[model samples]
Target: MGSVAVPSDMPATSSAEPSSGASNSPNSPSAEGSGNAEEEPTATPPSPSDSMAPQGKVTALRLADFKTRWAGGEGWIARTDDSGKSWKSQLEHKHIVNQLFALNNLEVWATLDIGDSKQLKLLHSVDGGAKWAEIGYVPNYSFLHFVSSEEGFSGNAHTKDGGKTWSKLPQPAVIAGDAYFHDRNNGWAVTQNKDKNTLDIVRTTDGGKTWTTVLKRTTAASVTGTVIRSAGKKDAWVELIGDSGMSQTSYSLFHTMDGGKSWIPVLANNQAGSGPAPGYKTGQESKVPSNTGSSPGALYVVNPKVAFMGGQCMACDLPNTMGKTTDGGKTWINLSSKFPGYGTQLIAAADAEHLWWINTDNAEPSIIYTSTDGGEHWKVTHTFDKPQPTTE
Candidate 1:
């Protein structure tokens, strides 16, 4: 009995049921509803290392260049065309791949979690990661976005006949948290309002049906998650997160060129309604190393100018910062003395100089950091191993 740690800002458990004519306009907020689709879980029995090859805990990744990639967690779905050096486990089962979508290495999709029974399933893969196919049953979607192989989006539900079939997006823009879609209808979300202490930044364009709450931040402390990123159509970026008392977590950085209407507070770690975001320089006068406090752990834009922000305080191991902005972000510089201070977890990109820094903070080994010359020289390519526990 050891599992009580839910505070990344809590707000995800919707039974959804708001389709048919969908609408929401008193400032839009209604589209998350759907519940009546869960009948695909009868085929268990393949856990004792399935045949040994795929490890666990990588949780969900989808690179596709710098040498192909794709990773899922615990129950495996691995792939690596040789950047992680070698890996190719394509589908071992025990169920625990929270979310993964690779729209190009030959179409793919995922969202499994059906072991300890929190229930969820939605897998697809058109031949890239070998084969996998269960295409329905999904709802605790805190976030998941696919652009094709039918169509997808699930901060609440939407499938155009790929994930079997699912719908409910005529309003509930997002009630739980996190979402990012730059195609199938344009998107961006970081929701959690209705007393969850405030953290909205919604915007959709007929894709998720409807939504438009441009911006809203209500913090005094006690906001825990929010991350939205975009790089094309007018640029976008966000990172709210709060609650910096002891467990540490404080962040702020909002920017929208013209998309979300308006926003620009490029980094307001002192959090309190935000200040300094006019064009450049805040904190250590734009040097970007406040002795490790604001929690910049990851963000990689790569467009509209250039971007990459970092911090990795694995519980205060500190000294793992990395910042850079070309102009769109106004100003930033500190490259963390050229890298490696540990604890990055995840950060990916394919432009503005390629990158893929991940450091699982030791889930058994996990470590990988690469950069094409953007973060200014970084290398350590791959190192992952430590995922073997399926019992059966």
Candidate 2:
């Protein structure tokens, strides 16, 4: 089933999306919206000497009938080039492109935040994801992307851009978390500012123009979100925080082959190198929920010796579950429970068994699921609708 393939070059970053509760510490009060349970999943399948039913290659499979006026929230595009069966829906005004980038199949890049004029609402399509054009205006920020197409970048506390023009981001990397690039003249970003309380890190190799802080430590490692790109440079992944300098309790888990200058911490809790991957639940709540790419521990580790992560059980979302590792992260498995959902924001995979996910229909109309034969099975299609009201 592997067919949608071509062009394996990538790089560029400045992605962010931190606004649910900031970090839940104003006094540690955040239920995010009141009634919870929308996404959180776990799964582990595709074994038996490795099943052969999974024929890969299927990017962005949407069937969303269409509806708006405020539904749920979270939008990501898809692509199909005579491969993965057949699918397309570039644009009609579904500006939620869940921070997307296709770079191949034709050309695509997305990001949105308008009205109060948060600025920067890019949407390009040479014709792949379909058709989209907004081109300029970028301010404020919540999440950004673009690892190709004139090269792009954006951040939360600082850093900003649009590519050939429209500026900001050219001095001591202020604060950013999860920006990626292995091409576009090399790229990398992971930050947490605050030099007074102690916790400063900065890096940028000419992409943003200038800056280098290295690592200053009040204890460092304290980012709750950002870093979930799937464009080579080795399929970037993020979600770090494992302190014990003695303030809280973290296990510290990270992975960045070479695109982030330097970072190495596969997994920890003092290390789980033995055996036991969720299957029945044993110790430390069966740990291993790393990679806070947001949207419920986001995942898409590309091919780190075979890996694919997912979560949704903040006390149960909808049975939301998915997880797998082919010896890279040491070992893991727990995928296949049907369709339990509580909170699973976004996840995308093409091979290993054609998989894609989108959850959190809290307000309703926000569900999209697809799996070809891996993860056992998953086929919802679409139900998106929340932005159709302008009778002025």
Highest TM-score scorer: 1
Residue 206 deviation, candidate 1, in Å? 4.9
Q: Which candidate leads the pack in lDDT?
A: 1
TM-score of each: 0.31, 0.28
lDDT of 2 at 289: 42
| Candidate 1, 149-249: lDDT as tens digits | 56665654667777787765544534534566554566677666556555667777766677788887654444466666665544578666655544445
Worst 10 residues of 1 by lDDT: 1-10
Give the Cα-based TM-score of candidate 1 against the true structure: 0.31
| Candidate 2 worst ten-residue window by lDDT | 63-72
